[model samples]
Target: MLRILFCLLLAAPALAAPPAEGPSPLWGMLQVIFGLLLVLAAIVGIAWLFRRFSMGSMLGRFQPARVVSGVMVGPHERVVIVELAEEWLVLGVTSRNVNLLKTMPKPAGHDAGQPAANPPFAQWLAAAMDKARKRQGDGDK
Candidate 1:
């Protein structure tokens, strides 16, 4: 057992490449760029597929028949909003279940024509979500 451990430890040193064989910074950067391009291509392909299926476009439209709303009263319980049509969808979002919360009007000085940045309240909501995740993890442990 001692001989086997000694031989294994000695052999492990030979597994790594020599300093001379290491890749240059330029080569590493090129590999990163290549990876990024592949990721962007995949995203574009998925978006194209989404557009082809007209799912995103269809989801933008709200259907009255399937616009039922209710409280999600249990752990992992979720509010589901569905749009019934040729292509149906069920969106499970906690925010949708709690739409009764007061909403402030959009801040002034921000042009309605241009898209607005996320409100400070959004950050607070994110912090609240993080707290919830931590609480859930604590409960599990």
Candidate 2:
């Protein structure tokens, strides 16, 4: 056992490459670290390009339907108004069924020159957040 251990210990230095074989160990280590960083930077750049450009044409050119508004009528039910082409569909949505309540031409405000009644997503989100904040403040009182 001692002979085996001693032989293994003597062989350890031989397992490593000679000092003149390649670049310095520090330089090799730095190359590997920089290579890893370069690959990670490339991945992040590609992701940013995809996220920035991927959805622009698709969403801008083809918006088939838009939900104009919705209101909850029950714990598990809602009444939604959706705009499709030139029509507005009033829908009653329950957990089990989606019933069409009415259909009408798009509202007068949507005449290309005027903005529609439904606010943009950012505005709606801000308003919803504001309401939530107000509710939270009220609760604290």
Candidate 3:
């Protein structure tokens, strides 16, 4: 019984070697971090490209640029618009009572301070109504 107990104790130590395959925990975590960083860089690059293109267009047309103003925003929504060149760009707007009007595709010499054709509330309501009507029609069909 004494000899058997000694043998069991010796065998336990043989099974204590650390794993020696694949990446360590630290390496795995580093890889995940690097991947995230790469993704972020790509997003930034794409955004830069878009900005450059938009700016180029504005410069090409030599249009006077203006900023959007007096807009309101809501908690559950955001608005984004890129006008010709850089005439008026309203990004992440959350106004419940805002309207968007059409502008000349080409650059205009003057600031055409026209209201947007569709207001935020009207657009949202119209979209919702259209969706509801479509759903009702589908049900009937």
Candidate 4:
């Protein structure tokens, strides 16, 4: 019985599961931080590319040339009238390009002092809704 007890004690140590070997907590944290840094770098790279590609249009907005008005012609195209010291340029703006469609002398009536270039969207929407309601009322009558 003494011999059997000693054997069982020795076997017990061998039978128990070995401690799980895994990356240390510090190493795991470092990997997470590195992954975060990679994502941050990618974001910054994309922003830089966007800014570089769009610099042409942005330059006019910042420089002596001022954007008088702009309207969207399509999902990815726009018509913009830019004002300079002497002349106004009509520009056709696309996703990756800007073209001068026309250039004309600044109109005598159009100057620095002007009301809001466009009416508030909310007011426009309200006006349309009223028109619709009037039409519906007329139809019912």
Pick by TM-score: which candidate is best?
2
TM-score of each: 0.28, 0.47, 0.32, 0.38
Off by over 4 Å in 3: 1-20, 62-141
Give residue 101's lDDT in candidate 3 (0 to 100): 44
lDDT of each: 0.58, 0.80, 0.64, 0.80
By TM-score, the candidates rank as 2, 4, 3, 1
Query: Which residue pairs show collisions in model 2?
Result: none
CA deviation > 4 Å runs, candidate 4: 1-63, 115-141
- Candidate order by lDDT, decreasing, is 2, 4, 3, 1
Worst 10 residues of 2 by lDDT: 113-122
- The TM-score of predicted model 2 comes to 0.47
lDDT of 3 by residue, 47-99 (tens): 99999999989776854544433333356555545464645554444435544
Output the worst ten-in-a-row residue range by lDDT, candidate 1.
81-90
User: What alpha-carbon RMSD in Å does predicted model 1 have with respect to the real structure?
Assistant: 20.8
Q: Candidate 1 on 1-141: residue-level lDDT in tens? A: 999999999998798676576798999999999999999999999999988789767877855544333334356554333333422233444633533332233345644335333444345555866999999999999
> Least lDDT summed over 10 consecutive residues: which range in candidate 3?
64-73
> How does candidate 3 score on lDDT?
0.64
Q: Give me the displacement of residue 79 in model 2, in angstroms.
A: 2.4
